[model samples]
Target: MHIWDVTNGARFSTYAIRADEGSGIISLNGGAARHVQVGDLIIVAAFASMSEAEAETFKPNLVYVDGSNTITHTNHSIPTQAA
Candidate 1:
């Protein structure tokens, strides 16, 4: 998973999601956590690769989430809010 802090414009590629959900909590154990905090809106994206040009042009699946990190929406296209 790719973890990005939208609030601070910081990106991390090695965040470990150590726990499954129940309490709607997100934890980061190392120095990366310093870039984020409570109430920060972030993007957690899962991705795949394609070798074909047509396949490469296609958008990846995205799960738009909120402050609590709960997914609020999903789509094949990147959301306009990202820009």
Candidate 2:
């Protein structure tokens, strides 16, 4: 997975997820955690390579959460951005 630090304009940094005793914790460790401050806006994105045909048929499951990190909803598509 790649973590993009949106607040600091940093490029993606590779990372491995570790299972924590306290579930539902989103944290950055090691060198990547050096520059990130608490409450920074970061995006964790994952990707998989597949054939073009497979890609066209792929629909990612998007999950939505509330401020408390509770899942509010989920769907396969996101609404279009307003013009």
Candidate 3:
């Protein structure tokens, strides 16, 4: 997927966005510091347009593309309630 860098005003191929050690912080592509945090989600299109959305429902720590061009969301789990 295409990732637009709002800071640098550039676009790149989004490899992944993983959470840092602490909660509510994510690392992007091994390039810079954690750019996105909890409650933040970015939508990237093929033509290099990025739209930001609030991750109120669920926040995915990591997003990557596989060999089949399918985007994968991992490293995040649903909150469990006390039984």
Pairing residues by index, what is the TM-score of model 2?
0.71
The candidate, 1 or 3, that scores higher on lDDT is: 1
Q: For model 2, how does the per-residue alpha-carbon lDDT over 1-83 read when each residue is reduced to its tens digit?
A: 77777789776667667756436567777887886777777766677899999989999877665544556888897579998
Least accurate 10 contiguous residues by lDDT in model 1: 14-23
TM-score of each: 0.60, 0.71, 0.28
lDDT of 3 at 81: 100
Which has the higher TM-score value, candidate number 1 or candidate number 2? Answer: 2
| Model 1: per-residue Cα lDDT over 1-83, one tens digit each | 67888888989876556676645677766887787887777777666666798686887777666656667888887547654
- Residue range 1-83, candidate 3, lDDT tens digits: 56555445555565655554435333464553245433334445433333455445555455454433355545565457998
By TM-score, the best candidate is: 2
| Pairs clashing within candidate 3 | none
Model 1, residue 82: what's the lDDT?
55
After superposition, the stretches of candidate 1 with alpha carbons farther than 4 Å from their true spots are 21-23, 53-59, 80-83
Candidate 3 lDDT score at position 78:
46
Model 2 has an lDDT value of 0.73
